[model samples]
Target chain A: MIDFIFHFTMIAAMIIFGLIAIEHKNLIYSAISLAVMSVFLGIIYFILNAPYVAVFQLVIYAGAVTVLFLAAISLVTKAKGEEED
Target chain B: MLPLNLLWWYLGAAAALYVIGLYALVSTRNMIKTVIAIEILIDGAHLNFIAFAATPTAGIDPIAHSIVITSIIIGGCIAAIALSLAINAYKHYGTIDIKKLRRLRE
Candidate 1:
């Protein structure tokens, strides 16, 4: 029962955040939502007993990937008075 | 192997993710959003892989975990390259809209 609840919650969160990430107008908000989704994905991985994979998801996807998105957003948005698309 | 009910549950989640990702990819015109859609698609695949790796007798398979890790790294690299390309395109064209790159074809 507990496992089922955990799975349901994580999957729901992943889906919701994923939609927010893709559909959000602001790139920063989208990127942050993606990070949140990644974190939930890592939790799901951990529940599935893939600890190493979970760590990598948290570190690579949630941490490094989000940072990359933020950097790119800032660079592009700030360049030559380029506005957000 | 996971029970039939559990297997379907996992598969359903994965499929939902796939659909969401594909919808975003097809509908969005922004370059960054396209990249994000790709990431979501990869994640859906990863979830499928993990779901199938679960076995009643042996627990989670180690090979599947390794595959997912490798995939995550590759996805990151792909995102970085794509973002850099998008940035370069923005620098040159002053716009991130995919529809505005007609000069590239000409």
Candidate 2:
């Protein structure tokens, strides 16, 4: 029963995060949402008995990837005078 | 004991995610949003592989996990490259909108 609940929650959270990440008007907000989504996905991986993948998801995606994206956005934002897209 | 039938539920969810990702990719004009939609599509594929690996009949396929990992890395690399190109396009064209990027085609 616990496993079932965890599975459903993970799926729901993944879907919600994906939507928010793609649909948000602001790129920063979308990037933040993607990071949050990666953290949740890490938790889901743990629930699914893949602790290695869970840690990788957290470190590589939530940590490195998010930082990379933020850096890219900053560079682009600085180069372009206008911010709204 | 959990019935194997429960796997179908996960499969359905993965399918739904794929559909949503496809819709976003088709409808969104923003380069970043399209990139994100691609990520979501990749996530759906990863979920399917992982769920299948968890099934008792599948015997926890390490091969599938390895493939998924490789694809994830490649997907990230592709996104990074695409974003850089989009930034360059913005620099040249002064706009990231797909409609405004028709100079190369003509």
Candidate 3:
């Protein structure tokens, strides 16, 4: 029961954040949401007993990839002189 | 015990994510949003792969782990490259909206 609840919660959180990441009007907000989703997924990976995979996901997705998205957004955010998202 | 609802839960999540990602891809006009949608789609596929590879008696599959790792690497590279291209597009077009880039598309 605990395992099922844990997985179910994490998956639901991931899906919710993922939708916000893609559908949100603000780019920076979307990027942050993506990071949140990735972290939730990493927890799910850990729960699934793929500890190495979970670690890699946290290092890669939440760490490196989110940094990449933020960098690109910072560059482009000012390109148009529009309000920061 | 584990085979009963666990399998369907993962499977259902995979399906829902895939559909949501596809919908985002079709509905979104921003290049960045499209890229995010693609990431979500890949994640959905990864979930399906992991779910199917996991067995109640045997445990998680090593092969699936390897594959998911590679996929994660590739997805990161693809997202980085695509974001750069979007940046360049924004520089030229002043917007990342796909509909405005008619010359490049045709």
Candidate 4:
């Protein structure tokens, strides 16, 4: 019974976060939401008995990837102001 | 007294999420949204692999877990490349919308 509940909860969290990541209009907000979603997914992976994946998801995704995205966003925004004709 | 048939239920749900992710990838025009949809699709694939790994099959499939890890890294690389391209497009054309980007095809 507990396993079933955990499974359902993880699915629900994934769906909710996936939707939120795409539905937001602001790109930065969407990226932040994606980071939050990734963290939640890591927790779910731990619950599912995949501790290595959970750790990888947290470190690679929430840590490295999210920072990379933010850097890209900042670079783009800076370039946007310079390109105006 | 718990239903063993619930395994099928989880599989079906994972499939449904995969389809939804595919639809989002197909229908979105924004580059960021497309990337996020791809992530969703990858997540669905991982779920399926993990689900099968949990089952009592002929043998243990550690390969699936390894594949999922490899795919996640690949997906991150793809996302980075895609975002960089999108940034370049925005810089050159001043927009990230795919519909607007078609003007450059001439």
Candidate 5:
């Protein structure tokens, strides 16, 4: 069935991206990978017929949480000369 | 006929994710990675909840869905507060390395 195929593919992708987020050295890359994994998870939710959960996952997680992560990364990794601003 | 064993797919994936998240939490040195791992662990648990609620014969449970919705809001709050705490820790220590964070030694 089409649903089965889609579900399997997304699940595989999710596993890889999640692992990459955990194993990456750079914090920013890890955050980016986490966002990608979240998107895949959202799609899985959609496929599983939980539209509300999927939408919230994309909006709250892929949007707000990733932004929060980048903001924290930015604050912590500030350049020396840019401190005046 | 669709195989009845399909539920195992979701459950297996959830178990694998939880294990990976636990490994990340234990092995990673960075605070941000730890936070991400925690999020992953919560997501795995969320998947398990939904998987059970989604069974065809058992019928969808609105109650489980409502609980998951609340958990999402709470998880978001936890992530925000944890990241802010990490920011403060970075400011105080100049680095997030846990090994260098011993204040009582100095």
Candidate 6:
């Protein structure tokens, strides 16, 4: 029962965060939401008993991918004065 | 094997993810949002793969797990490339909105 509860909760959170990631108007906020959703996805993998996949999901999606998105957002949105840098 | 009930639950969640991602892809005009929609779609497929691999009769299939890992790596690469392209597009067009970009092109 506890496992079921945890599984269901994580799955629900993943879906909610995914929606927020795509629907949020601000690009930075959308990237953060994607990271949060990825975290929940890692937890889901753990629940499914794929520890290795969970670790990859956390490290790649939550860590590397989020950083990449944030970097892209910052690069693309810099002020006019900062564009020369 | 995972209980039939649990399997159904996981499958349903995967389907929901697919639908959400598809809706976002179709409705969103922002380049970054389109990339995000793609990530969500890939994640949905990963969930489907993992859900099916959860059979108890045999421990989690090593082959399937490896495939999922490979897919994850590929998905990361795709996101990086797509974001780079989006950044380049923004540099050239001064906006990330696809509609604006189309107008600028014409």
DockQ each candidate and list the results: 0.66, 0.44, 0.54, 0.35, 0.41, 0.51
Candidate 2 residue B90 Cα shift, in angstroms, is: 1.6
Give the TM-score (vs. native) of candidate 3: 0.90
Clashing pairs in 6: B1-B56
Which of candidates 1 and 2 is the stronger one according to lDDT? 1
Instruction: Please tell me how candidate 4 rates in CAPRI terms.
Output: acceptable
Q: Quick one: ranking by lDDT, best first?
A: 6, 1, 3, 5, 2, 4
Which tens-of-lDDT digit does each residue in B1-106 have in candidate 2? 2247867877876786788789888877777767767767877787787778767787677787777777777767877887888778768876676755775558
Q: Considering the true interface contacts (CA pairs under 8 Å between chains A and B), give the fraction that model 3 also has.
A: 0.51
Candidate 1: lDDT of A76?
Answer: 70
The number of the candidate with the highest DockQ is 1
Off by over 4 Å in 4: A77-85, B1-6, B58-60
**What TM-score would each prediction reach against the true structure?**
0.92, 0.87, 0.90, 0.84, 0.90, 0.92
- Could you tell me which residue pairs clash in candidate 1? B1-B55, B1-B56
Q: Considering the two chains of model 6, state its CAPRI-style docking category.
A: medium
Worst 10 residues of 3 chain B by lDDT: B1-10
> What range of 10 consecutive residues in model 2 chain B has the weakest lDDT sum?
B1-10
CAPRI-style class, candidate 1: medium
lDDT of prediction 6: 0.89
DockQ of 1: 0.66
Q: Which stretches of candidate 2 lie over 4 Å from their true place?
A: A78-85, B1-3
DockQ preference between candidates 1 and 2, better one? 1
- Native contacts retained per candidate? 0.65, 0.21, 0.51, 0.28, 0.44, 0.72
**How would you encode candidate 4's per-residue C-alpha lDDT over A1-85 as one tens digit per residue?**
8878876786677667767777776668867877887887777666555677778878877777777777776666543444211
| Residue-level error in angstroms, candidate 4, position B13 | 4.1
Can you give the lDDT of residue B25 in candidate 5? 86
When 2 and 3 are scored with lDDT, the better candidate is: 3
